[model samples]
Target: MGNQPETHPNPTIDPKSGFNSETRTFQSLRPKTPLPPLSQPLSVTDYTLSLIPSTSLSATAMIDSDTDTHLSYSVFIRQIKSLSSSLKSLFPSLSKGHVALIISPSSLHVPVLYFSLLSLGVVVAPANPLSTHSELTHHVQLTKPVIAFATSSTSTHIPNLKFGTVLIDSPQFISMLNNFNNSEPPRVEVAQSDVAAILFSSGTTGRVKGVELTHRNFIALTGGFYYTNLMLGNLDEKESNKVSLFTPPLFHVFGFFMMVWTIAFGETLVLMKRFDFEGMLKLVEKYRIDSIPVSPPLVVLLAKSELVNKYDVSSLKIVGCGGAPLGKEVGESFAARFPNVIIEQVT
Candidate 1:
């Protein structure tokens, strides 16, 4: 980590721009509202600044649309503030826009880590748990994250990439939160154009390309889908939809935009790190999944899995396929086998 660029704990005006790249982006217009100018210089670490998170700030958050978990947004923020203090001692120069890869499995941790980093003006790079060593390496290379927060499960898989890393196995997240109130909140600037996330898209060429999604760009895309689905009454289209995503990586925009955004609203998503026919069928039986979002090849495999008949798939109503066009015969066969399942092709 010695070769790493020195972190700027305080907001420093870029010599050329004389403006903070992070601050400019945050001051830019958001989808719903324009970011207000700061009356005084603000530190990214100081989350109390009403401008950064705007009115989204809260004491408790009611997350867990998939499970019945009562989460508090207020308590969660306090934990993040505590973590920030702990991390400061370990990382003296951490900047506001520094990227951190979150690798925890607890659904509760996702929102906590996400907002915590955001509060510090830190960008997040969420990788798939099933990502191979090579895949993780590519992501590290592309984003050049300052640190990665993960469990011991993935600690061994990080290849030759160079960056500061943190382990968050159970007691660790709490331990980090223990050291609270010692350091200042990060004082970096942010903007809508500044990327909140850079998801790697596994293109048709098989090479992973990072998709730079600015805060506004992401909000627009997610908001568009939200509005379109609402107008079209497709809100429930994915609700309780029992489907397998054989092709989509949650890291990809298609997965996050198409699959995740809906769940944030109210859909109960059956998250599978990777698509396996037998495993998916087992899930269908166990959870009584209603519809599955899949790719063309998986749609074909669904017909072959014959395991579909072994489970109680009567709850399923939507079977979606995309990424490439399926042949008419393949589509017909899928329909014949899943007669009760409505076939949806991406328009």
Candidate 2:
């Protein structure tokens, strides 16, 4: 949290402005402002927006592609500010507890959309794009979301999901972005125990059951390990970190929290929709990537992929693995392939 300003002012600040008779001039002063925590009733989405006027710190979400990028840290937060401008008006009659589902490929849109839902004191259920039609429909039906924002990447799959999926990358979405305002949305009061996210353990443990990770759980993960920079140490050259090549799916908890939130730390995440041995290696070498958070299965491919030896991956410092166990032999193979890359497990 080095630059993550621990203190913020109040959200509702009313300054008194009146003519000072003694001084014979107009005077005004504002009291201590609301410093709401990102997960608080106001949500970090709004907190992120408040920082935009200060400087341009980026929180980029790359849904793949080198140029098709949106929002760095500050910019990302600002974009969130823009998106939240029409919250209640967008869904006037819905309860504050009802969620707004976001299924987009634009990395910029994901955090703001999700956090905006959370800020309203609603629960979030992220459906994986790779999930089958039945799987996607099951989660949708199970949760019964009120509003949804989805990308065309898998539009055909949820053709009849009984929800309005705001096409964020389409002409309509562009118009929405262009016409969006910066006014804050109606904030809701949330408790620490409120469910911030619902994560499912990978099928390794059989059918996935939604693991209700509350706001407290999210705070601990970020405040405890991730924000401490356990994975990005290798990314640092002298004093700053390097851009990371992200090949994991955004829906996976490993990618969503671990990689997605890494943006606020002033790091770049280069996303690849899905892992391709050759393609991933090319990007790593191309970007001179500093860090990567991946799975064990993919690690094996990264270890054995001809691209490892075919190109330069010397820039890589650490490989963070989650969602499964990596065998000693496989770990050794990965170590042998990239001696500079340290492997860490979160199982």
> Each candidate: what lDDT?
0.58, 0.61
Cα lDDT tens digits for candidate 1, 276-315 = 6777776676655656767788888887776767777676
The estimated TM-scores of all candidates read 0.62, 0.75
Number of the predicted model whose TM-score against the real structure is largest = 2
Please name the candidate that would achieve the greatest lDDT relative to the true structure: 2
For 295-345, candidate 2 gives per-residue lDDT tens digits of 899889888876567887788888888777888999999998778788999
Question: Model 2 Cα displacement at 96 (Å)?
Answer: 3.2
Q: How far is candidate 2 from the true structure (C-alpha RMSD, Å)?
A: 12.9
Clashes of 2: 12
lDDT of 2 at 211: 65
